[model samples]
Target: MKNKKRARSYPVVQVLSKTVYLAIPVIILFIVVSWFSFSEIRKQNNLAVENTVNIYQTELGHRLSAITHFIQWTVVHDPILDGFVRENHMGDYRNASNELRLRVSDMQYSTGDEYQYFFYWDEKDIFFNASEIKVDYDTYKEIKEKIRSDVKSKEDPTGSFSWKPFSFGGKEFLYYMITYRHRTFACLVSMEDILSPLYSLNLGENGSISAISPDGEVFYKTKEGPAGIISSVYNRQLFPASKSLLPFSLAIDSRVLGNYGKLFVLQVIVFLAALMLSFIMAGYILVSYKKVILPIKMFSKSLSEMDSVSDGEGLDLTDSKIQELNQINEQFKNLIHEITRLRIDIYEAELDKNKFMIHFLQQQIKPHFYLNCLTTVDSMVSLGDIDAAKKMLMFTSKYFRYLFQVDMNTVPLINEVQHVEDYLSIQNMRLSRSTLYEADIPSECNSMEIPPLLLITFIENSVKHAVPPEGESLKIWIKCRMMNHNAMEIIICDNGQGFSRDVLTKIRNGEDMEEDGNHIGITNCIKRLGLLYDNNFKLLTENNKPRGAKITLRIPVNDK
Candidate 1:
């Protein structure tokens, strides 16, 4: 016969496969998101560069216009210019030019510029004098020719002016001039000073400004060399002296193009890194689902199988693939053992209830029997059988009253001590033994709550088991006091034969006593103390110093 092949079972493998299937969509989503983020960053960077260029252009244009307006105002308002024109003298013109030059230099310092020079032309003498002590002869000649030409042609001279190839102190300047109606003065401010306002405007580290004349002459430039010049552009035709001015054309710096390229490369690198991290995260989740989730699922399955087993039936859940599942299976077995323990506890509770009912019924019968017997004995004592009837009546009524008075369970220490005295009184009447019972219970501990029947049981046990022999008087002492700020302790001691070592050990360890059924009362009291106070109570039993037994019960005060 051919052997049949068994089907393979691997929960981890199955879980891993499912996780990989789920990760496909997540990986695709991460890639799409990264791509969009990269694209948006690039777009935003381009817009930033464009906006920077636009702002610089607008600010440069405004600065250039302000410089031109200042020069026009100086020519029209200066006292020196008016004085020189009224006198029409070359010396007066020289003095006036020198004074104006000093004033203009001080103004230049405040305006954040290198120089501000003024020039004057007399139409009558055909003479020209500039504000500076030394003038560029070539620049002076060029301006003289332009003014003479305008005069000969009888053209309108009160308008905006421009000069190209104008040399000043061996350096070139693109001169911008404005003519006045009554005074013929040409203001010559360097193009460098005209755009110098850009430096003080604080355009930030990455921006530049430039000022250009109508004739394509660069007045000033920020940044040096080719980078500065190449960055600024001027349109001569659009800004001619004969034509209306046009707005400056603005554009992104060519150097910023390289920056954008570098940024694009960086963005590409970031996108690739993000993609790799996303893949790594997906792999980690898949591995976790396989390694952790699958094992837990197997453990859960084993528990379900174990739960289906009947009582006393064992389950085999030793799977070699998952050690954690094996441990869970072992825990399930322990749970089964715990269930057996619970069943035993239920049985014991029922037995205890039945025993309590029997005890309660026996107690009820003792009272009725004692009352009837006591009545007959009292009557006989009255009719001359006094000693016999008195002894019988005392013994019967004392014990009977104790057994029947269920309301005396949680009586105060003082009251419990009085009850003990009453029992001793009945015992003295019955026997030839004379025993003294003294109680010293603190008044402060009187109101502290204690379980009912606890003290009575201990007192009864002491009296019944520790009666003195003939001719020896028995002495019992009971004392209660606050042992500490939070605890109350009661000590009961007697001058009777103490218990053996074996009996003391058994009582301390809560072992059942085999000698008498009356030990049940002490056992019940111990159980009640444990249930009521838990860890807040202590009971100790020991032999007194010379002879007798001492029992002490310590209970924590209820602050509530």
Candidate 2:
């Protein structure tokens, strides 16, 4: 045992010992420390850029909020504009317009003339700006039309301030409009002027910043190239008070994160050397796994798969490139072969036993059925109905002759169906009641094979229990169809008194179901199906709605 252990130990241990030199630990430690330091630097730089973007977002949001408040206070809520709307005098209009211009001019002066303001009186067709500049009525109408178009295209229902982008005089301006009682007040800021503060920010050599309008138009961008690691801050996210402001985005290029001034080249060289050493270490580890670990896994998997090898098929394990593993696999294969031979012998014996048990079960129901037929015939003869007795005997004779084909484990589906028809006729004659029988057996499924007398057992149960009202006839249906290329289905149902709850439970639980000679026929049929099909067939029984019993059988088929 010690020799065997030593033999298994040499290949794995020797390969590992040779691969792991003293310098390997030093190199690995260096790589780890360097990676941590480099990652920290990049993380810190990215965090700093994100902080700057957030700060800018806040400041820009505050400025826009103040402007919006000023417009609301001066134009929308002022008494001067309200008087101009209500009064019909021309003197009142002139006074209100002058006051509005003065207020807007003062705002522009205070904000370094960054925003242009306009007030339009819808009643008089008059429009004026902060600079007291007046345009022709045609130009005013064009501007009004543009504002209407922008409002229709980009209206924000959640807020009173509606911000939109509109092109006027070949320049795109961010337009902010607020309409109050048919009087419109608006503010306009050029994209270039709005993003002027962002231009002065020191965002590395390859860093970029952009302002995007609500309609996804890029109002302004500092750099025009492929962006990297974008960080975004929407206007509403930054300033909830001014929900209609523009959104901003910033990106810091990956190349900028690696820049370390004078030490940039040296650091790059070190990083590349560390990455190459990591690859070398990974390659050595993979080689060791292939040489040692993989063979043991294959051996374990082969042993596990041996449980399913029942037909004497060889395992045919591949060569594991190791002498000891190969020898172990060969021994395991030989042991499996012996076990398979014994299993096959036992399996054949069990199969023969199952066949005999099925034949015996089939015979168990015969005596009861034959005795009932004979009694029915005797009753007819005593009543002086000789012709009825003769018809009953003829149907019973045909059914019995079909049943006597005990050697055949399966017969064509059409033959089984014919057998069911004979059984139904015999039962009708015996009961002296009319039965409404319907059959829907498709021609495609006529040639498929199924166990003999399989249909009649369910039909017999139906006929015996199918008790309709005084004037109603017993209703029974047999349906057969091919389920797919590999299976067929048979269904038998009746519109009479369905199965009781207790009997259905017994059938589902696979119990004997022999209460007062009640469910013996169905129980025997289930046992026979089990022996013949193993686990390849399905049988189900249920009580149909509004009074009926249904039995469905799905049988697997093999192509001839």
Candidate 3:
């Protein structure tokens, strides 16, 4: 016989490799999304810096413009500047200076000393600070000298009103001057004071703010030497007010964009961790398949090929890595061996039971029946009826011979009917009464085979129970016919008191009727029929219409 090839199992590595194949596109997608997110973060940071710089520029420009307007108005409207321009004598200067000093002192007292007010007279060659009496002598002298030197060395303004950048003690200030013929009025504003609100701004670790000149020189900065991919906003684009006045620019660092490097590092770490986990899980699955799933498949295949325990004596076995699976395999093999041994024991037990039942049936008819036959035969001989005695002896010999033929499991229907007739004749002669016996057996049914003594057992039951008192005659009917193509039916009935309800109920239910050693003939007949025909035969016992016990048997027959 040609053997069919078994299919190969799928490799676990190939299954795990599919996950790596799927991850390639996912990694690409992740990078693309992260790039867009980084770009958006940069753009938002730039916008925030631009907004902060613009706000600062607007406030500073507004303050400078207001101060300039107020100084110009006071110079044009007050009589102090007119006195300085028209009078040159020291007395006249002193009288006018006293009134001017009182007015300037009043102005300084009205507003905080955020500015230093100065006045200059070209003819008198007098350059002095009008509101300096309140300042410390040394500090005031230092500031006055620096301003005096710068004012003298400085070039004259190209316009009547002009702005200039001034530095004093490392602080930035804007110097404003107004020229009225021979007299000049000017004031100094500290740039640091104007920008003080932004000192507490929440710029990141590597972030800063700076005020720069148009020439790229830093006037003031919050932090020195700021580092990293810092994004900045220029004041020229958002706030143009500072362009004409020294063209200073405000700059704010957007440090949020610089933090992208840390974010990207975190993302890479997470991706690598996930990849490592996937590898571990794949390895686990492979180990489980080899140790658990593979062994189970082998066990199932072995079971499928097995026809019987004896035939499968050499079962395919493999040691599994798992202890529980090995134990189960051993237990399954032991169970098969146990089942094989139990089957032989059960078969021998059934054979012994059949032999014991047959032997009992053979012995059952001899004891009481032999004594009755002897009594009848003795009586016959005593009357000098020698021919009757010989007839009775011949019939008894045939009856005992038939009853003892335990080896003949089945006999032809005609032989069983003949044995029954002989038994009935003996009973009639012994009782000295004639019983009516009729047989309606067809020629076809006479050759049918049935269990030996099956029909006679029922007939004997009728003779024992249905034989009436001396006056009334007993009528026995035996009928046989073909029931179907493969079966025959036999019916035996007798006109007498029918079976009691208790006996009929026990018979129909197939309950034991031989518990008291009674009805052993009928019990043995049923057991022998079961042994011969199994379920293919049917037997029915019921009370006939009118008054009699009826026994019907349907037996399967071979064509021969």
Candidate 4:
């Protein structure tokens, strides 16, 4: 037979093809999603930075305006500064300084300074600090001159100055100057005031904001460089990073970009999704193999186990998870039941055929043996040996009666043995007691059920083959014994030349008799044994040590 292309033992056991197709689309979708997400992240991040800067700038400007309005309120409400603006005495300046200290000293910590006041009278070219004699000595020379020029050149007497160092009483002050009426007053200020709002912005890890004065001085900057130099993409995009083009610009930190690595996040999401998909696909394949392929394989294996000749049973249907497979299993079970019934019918037909063949062979042998026996009886009667003739005629009549009445398939062991004894009696009488036949069957084994003519064929073969020695009578032993609980053994041995080598080979090979049918008795015995015992019964023959044939049959016994 030609070997065709082999099929997979199990298709689900092979690699699934959907992985690449699923992965490619998943990757593409992830890329598109990540691109949009990154764009939004940058936009939102820039918007957040812009909002931070805007809020801080607005707060600073409002605080400064509040401070200006507060100063005007004090000038109108306090009599000390009013007295100093009305009177030109060192006594009034001292009172004004005392009032300034009382009003501003409690707020010094928020501004990074001690409460020190300095007032300059522009008309007199005179300045009075909190200590009129101490601060009036030296450090006010530059600010006093600038105030004079500013009071003459400006339209309004109200003015202000940026922070400057004024060394008075060996103490440096970051001073601011402002004019109220004709008196220019200077106060100390610092970056700590702006820092309160600056720090409040959410600068997050590497974020920074800068507040630069219009004069290009860095009033407050959390970091050194500009935001553009930090990230290459920062240069291409612009934001309201500088709020109002005034105080400061805010930038989200670039160095600690871990929080916004959206690409990495997208990759992780895609990886997890793909991993989950793979597990789902694997589970699907496993389900298919279990519910579909595995059941088919199991059915195939069960079919392999069946036999048409010897198997008289049906296969059991396996279970399945799918409903279709369950239906298939049900159909298979029904088919197997039908097959089993057919096999049983075939078995019964063969059994009936064997029984018929046995009956036909029995008929052929019975008439021949009976004819010879009647002829012997007639000769004996003619020779006036009336007693010998009666014995022969009576034994022959008894054997024929037993044979015609008994069941051919099975008979009691004792009855068959009695039948054998009756036949041997006729043979010994005819031969004048030339044969010595021994039947060693026990009473317990006598009721065992065996084939009706089982012992007769063996005995007939022995009678035909045995040739008595020159001086000794031929000895035959038909021994029956209970071998075990389930069976009995019968041994028929004779002192005769055993089978020839060719005949023994044919018997061992289990061949049927040839056309001439030499030793047909032995062949018929073997056929009956096969019909009744199948291969379970033992039928062995061997040459005995003293030149005889030993035939041992182990057959199942029935007591009832």
Candidate 5:
């Protein structure tokens, strides 16, 4: 046993030990690369944020300047202003005011809502509207006083405008006041209209944008908060420097800046990939021990323990820890079933040895296999799939008997197709309605002999990767037809996530290296086919239109 253990240990333990050292440096390299990637990403993002803020502020400046110019041009060029201000050409004040308001209707601006228009006469110290517009005078008076106070406080008010929020009658308005050449103009805009642009900007998740007065009062804040408290408290984290929109400067949250969400997700993916690759490399080395060495041990032990032909009849290994043991155990269980079936033939072996040998290698189906099937049947019955489970139970014994009876590991294509259908029926009941499979093969092709479980591998791939999410139907199609020159063609197509280019490439090359859960099962099957067919087979793979993937294989119709 010790010698056997040492013999089995050499390739895996020695190679994996060396490979582990190589993986450490590769892991470190990834970490350094990831660090630099995040740094560069953030550096670029900061530059982008700074540049974007500058451009936005510049554009906003232009927009505000346009509004400033509009107000300034309105006051200076008013035909009626000459009559009212100079006290010379006043025929009727109402008619003049009506004319000025009509002229404003022809104006175009970016804002969707209208702005309040008021004219201030410096000499009379009185305010008058260009037309009768709905505004709460008391609220406007308070906001106007705040603006006047702010303008008075400023050392230089030229080219400057004051704005403040005022609310009345359950509606909020922003009052913008500018003093122009012996007169003042106040424009009232709804608060919603002013903050609409800020709301639309893609400020990162948990980040917000707002406008703050010179006195540090916030009147325009984006309303996305359960953690509004964070914005209130984390002033240090704020990027309060997008060039002032006249009387107020814009503040954006820049502390957690630069697409941190994407960067962190990328880092996690890389870190996990590296870690998984390391483990997979180690796991791949252990496959030789699991597949070859362990099976030899199981067979040797089974052969040794058999005292009589009857003692060998129940040699099933259920004690092994390795998952690979299950396959060898199943083979032994089928072998025992064949022995039980040929018990009477063996008694007559003294007369015809060749006939007994042939009968001893095939099936009667083991009790253990039947017990497992019944247990599964009981489970499905409890889950309300009693009818489907009953049908599967009936097919289970027949499938198992046929599965063991295939003399040289090959069977008629019809039997293989029926086996797959029965398997699908059982699996479909287990995962009710999530997947639907359809098989279409010409009847003439049914007699062709192919390796057992060969086609099922591709079918199983479709099952795992192609199932749609809830409320959506997943469709899988298996089609086969005889091809030219004594060849058979089979296609398995599914409407799943489809294969990635890397996975498709690996499968096409028959390399069982993918750890993506979906790719591993497929390429393993391809590897088996390569061993079986050598260069006699042809395989093609491609992504299907709109969704899913297609796998096509061509093999000789004659099993020989």
Candidate 6:
């Protein structure tokens, strides 16, 4: 009869098994596709940023070079500049300077360059060819001095020049100076000519350009101030001795990348929605299989085997075509076999429980010894020395309190630290020696959780095994900090005799040693860690340099 039922149940199990195997590959394919898509998107985004930088850099370089070339042409060909220089009359020079300044300003206005629209020339103490405005003589002298120094030391005469602050029009200017020399002319061209080209060139929405003369004077700038640029030039080392090109950087107030970020956010929303839909469909399929399909299929197949059941013969449906359903039917037959085995297991489990109870009873002897020690403490309280008795009572209370607080398997790191402090306070009293405990815990991780008693146990062990002899002080240092976004580390180190080789070996192998009373605490700690966190919590015991011990516990931030 049992064999007949077993044969009848085989096909259903086989069918379910085959379906699971097929589903695994389908799930893997989905995950692979999603990962590849995300990776490709990220790569494209980075490439876009690099391309934008390169485009702006090239455009700015071309515009600047063109402006310099135009200035060289103007200085060589302009008849007004020639007339002013040859005549050397102040009135003629002033008229020529005004006219030339007007021309430069008109050119700038026509080209829509709003950064700069003025030109100036300084010879001795007089300013010439300025934009119809008289510049301060002292300001021009300062500008001239800076320009002269830069030109005299320049290794590359034709290159675009940058300068520090030099005076112009009573205000400081960071200017770019270009000197032009022809057969009959030698003159300096301020960065006024480039303002038109700079304004016309596209540098994205937030990008800017500031041209600085070799004398640290401002010649032309798309931005308002040179403080940011001055800081950059002074602090950052410039590369390539020939042409210096600073890449166009995105502005802090830019709204351009907001659109791209929004697109990425939209993609995330869609991906999550698709994943939720897939989970819902998968859950529905699983529910249908468990509630309606499997049972109905089993009942239908069982009806076909009624004839074989009545004939008192063993049926053979194990070879049915549906392999998974057949295996499930076989499992039903095996369940009866499992029931008989379970009876034998129950008997074995009872014997094992008895043995464990015996072991537990034997371990109760240690607590009995602790209780007797407490009685002695009570007697001491009855005597005159209340302080000594109070110390003993406090230590006993803390030791038992920690052991009894089993409800708190995990606690906030701050609570664990408090427990350590309580333990240390009692230990310090018991030893009657000054023990320094330095705690530097970051505020961010104060509320982060960790396994209870994990850190305190190590600290207690250090106080127990590493405290120096009479008349000597002990120091225990502790620091609790977050390693990154999702992990916190506790470092507890002491300065006393370090652990011996034999003790270190015992800890590594998870062995409990009977030689030292201190070993019991460490062993219990290891066991508790195993039960609470499995293999996730790490406890390391090592020797400190020269002498002493360092015990570090690293727990995952979200493990609890």
Q: How high is the CA lDDT of each candidate model?
A: 0.59, 0.69, 0.69, 0.64, 0.64, 0.57
> Which portions of model 2 show Cα errors greater than 4 Å?
1-52, 55-63, 66-70, 73-338, 349-431, 439-453, 478-491, 514-517, 528-540, 544-546, 552-560
Top candidate on TM-score is 2
Ten contiguous residues with the weakest lDDT in model 5: 356-365
Candidate 1: tens digits of C-alpha lDDT, residues 204-254: 344455444454555444543233454342111112222223122222122
- Candidate 1's displacement at residue 544, Å, is 1.3
lDDT of 5 by residue, 1-560 (tens): 86665444233345456667767777777888677766666565556556666666666566666666777777667665555555644456556666666655444335223666666655555556643456577766655565555455655544645456666445666666666565666667666665565554445556666666667887666644326555542222234434445545666664333555667777787877687776767675586566447656876786677665463455555433334454666687677778877986766754454343243333123466467667778887888987768786777756676666665646788888887776576566555565677889887788888877666667767776675645778787889988865889999888877888887777666666646456565665555555556668888889888888898889987743
In model 4, the clashing pairs are none
lDDT of 4: 0.64
What would the per-residue lDDT of candidate 3 be over residues 270-314, giving only the tens digit for each residue? 577567657766776786576458766877877777765454564
Candidate 4 ranges with C-alpha deviation above 4 Å? 1-322, 325-348, 355-364
Cα lDDT tens digits for candidate 2, 1-560: 96665445334556677667734875777777666666655665555555655676677666677778887776657786875655568777777778877887777776647677777656666666644334445645666676555444544522366456666655556678776655667887766676676565445555555556545556555566334344221111122222433344433332324334534654766677677777777878797777767766876787678668754575645543455565564676677678779999999978886776666646635787799999999998999999999999999988888776645667788887888788888877866687879999898888887777677778778777767656789899989888899898888888888888888899899998766789788888887777778768888999888778989989986533
State the RMSD for candidate 6: 12.7
Q: Distance from true position, residue 361, model 2, in Å? A: 9.0
lDDT of 6: 0.57
Cα RMSD of all models vs. native, in order, equals: 26.7, 11.2, 37.9, 36.2, 23.5, 12.7
Colliding pairs, model 2: none
Least accurate 10 contiguous residues by lDDT in model 3: 1-10
In the range 344-363, model 4's lDDT, one tens digit per residue, is 99999898877766664565
